[model samples]
Target: MGLFRSIVGGISNLFNRNNDGLTITKLVDLLNQGYSLLQINSNIYDIPEIRTAINFVAEKIGSVPFYHVRADNEGNMDMINDSFQYVLTVRTNKYQGPQVFWTHVATMYLLNNNAFIMPDWDNRGNLTALYLLPFTQFQFAQEEETGKLIIQFQGNSSYTFYYDDIIHLQRFPTFKGGASKQATGNYITMVNAMENQAVKDSETSGRIAGLLQTKVNLKSSDMKKKLNEFKDTFLTAENVAGLGMIGSEYELLPFNFKDTPLNTEFLNSIIKQLYNYFGVSYEIINNIASELQYEQFVDNTLKPIIYQIEEELTYKLFSKGEISFYNKIQAETVDLEISTLAAKTAFYKEMSYGTIMTRNEIRRRLGMPKGPPELDKFLGNKNFQSLEPGIYEVGGQENNPEDGK
Candidate 1:
């Protein structure tokens, strides 16, 4: 029955035509052909460096909490702190949670240069659930006359979704104006090479460990019998471990194949290149990055991606009025610890004395609880206070111009 169904499905797929009259079979064939064009290739997930790079960025982005805020008529932004925030950051849908969904989306975008989010709307068009689609499974197409975009999920059991109902995130810009696109650049080649090198190294190591060869001198007539006897006696694991041959005629020789040492430096170089390509520093990968460098990594590499996602979410999820009021999503910064208490103290002291940041802002940076409303105001040391137009005092009380008179 299953075989019959599969056959029927295959037949249906062969004849299945999309809105543009392209058969599913032809599309599948084209996709297969495209994949075959690459000499050495692998899934992004299979490559450790690629996986690490993508996950490093994705996990950091996912770990940071997402918040929504709207600007009032007077233009002061306030946090929404509502159900929508929960839906967006905690639980995306019934089947999948937010972190997993976002991680998958980030992985897709990094690998394929595209990601998709589909919102499941309720009766009144309110979003009930958000789902991340497999970007590779879907292709975007446009109507000739109406110019409406369509998403076709290619498989034996296919599904079609409207473009308006889906949120698309594209990494590389498509200035030529095509609906369907491939991933950007030749990073896949690097990933493939790295994977291939690792495989070769593993195979070489296995050969060195387990491979054995023996040379024996025996009469031609007795060769077969002697070989069988040798296999039964010395080749057994127990005999190989403990047995000692008392004959000088038989010799056990280790296989001596001089192999070039694995080019570890070359592998390291490739790893570094992959890390740089993905905007991950070697220090971060090796767990040796300073707090400042880690912060900079987040800012320089991950923040742009966060901002992109925020902008897209804001535009797609919110209404026009909400958007006009500057309602948007934001990813919180991941905090890093100072090297020492002295460093932390000096940092906070400078921040406070220079009035560089408000007390609450300082607390937030230090991963502390927010202080009272008064702490929200930026206040410098009394010694550094400006008094009476241009007069300033380092330590003494302020001298009024009238008092001198």
Candidate 2:
């Protein structure tokens, strides 16, 4: 059966919540049923730091425009305006454009280090639409009788599909038939503790203003009243900065937390490792990166992902003979696409004069929508051009290039 029909059949089989791996310290409603607080604390998407890093990558990778191209005799690759490239660069399906589709795919890939893309095929096995497969868990096995490989997804409901034409992206594959399952496991406990501590600190920050010790032997009820009075005097927003005038017999031990923040440094230190694991720095995540830093991020982090997608798309979408003849995908990182405004302006200055790039091409880099087809041609430098030795229309007379200005 076709993958789409199978998915429609399996729509009722949403995944059941499973928390088999974690020893729960807290339960989180932020994530879906199976994901607990402990699970999220361990560098999953729920953690703010980790999510920021992952989203930075996902959005950037998704934002990158792709191209389908073929090589000529000069070894230079030229873009081909075919349906394949159009679908990848403009629209993936009826519902999603390039950004949303690729962002989701990247998120899934980064989250699991494994993802599957089912390429719709025509009657002749030519590529058509693409779909991102949905599954909470998956496994691969071979049929004993047919000896054909099969992939099973145990989500809300279980469904297995033949491995035919299924593009599997896996990192660190293992004998167990999937990517070697590794996550941010090095600092889960510490991160959980720190996160909890921070929450507790935030909750009781002002309430625990100081300790009050008195020599007066008061009843429990009276003591509660007195404590309330003290808290009201010092903890209340109106008198938070006011000095307390306590009796001589009482001791005032103020809880000094103004100078020290809760778990910020320690948490950042631990989460920095998470960022490093995902191949992003704070500069990249926060978008405060320099040109050098951005380039390094692209080279160190984004290149691997782009390469994997390109290779897989090329191989799966084309036959070996087709590939040998140079039909392939080329994921060109549009210079103006992900570049900063300053970089775009500088690039425009450099290329706007000479016929280096077409107007629409430059406009694309600047994040502008495509203009009319007339702008598709290269721009000529009008600043200085050799005047042809012919009549020029000027002041009711013809001026030639040889006629000096």
- Winner by lDDT: 2
Model 2: per-residue Cα lDDT at residue 176: 48
Q: Rate the local accuracy (lDDT) of all candidates.
A: 0.62, 0.67
lDDT of 1 by residue, 319-343 (tens): 5666666777766653323434666
Query: Native-vs-model 1 lDDT?
Result: 0.62
TM-score of each: 0.64, 0.68
Which residue ranges in model 2 land beyond 4 Å of their true spot? 1-43, 76-78, 124-126, 136-164, 173-180, 206-208, 214-244, 247-250, 255-262, 336-338, 345-405
Backbone clash numbers for all candidates listed: 0, 5
Give per-residue lDDT, candidate 2, residue 340: 77
lDDT tens readout by residue for model 2, 1-405? 123434443221221223121111111222335532123124467677777877888898887777788887789887877668778887786557888888878877777777777665454333456776654377777767677776676644555665555667766566644463556676656777788877877777666666777789889898888878776765664476556556576678877654445667878888888887878987777668788988888888888888888988887666677677787887768562447778777677677667677888788865799999988987777764788898764343255444543
The residue-level lDDT of candidate 2 at 289 comes to 73
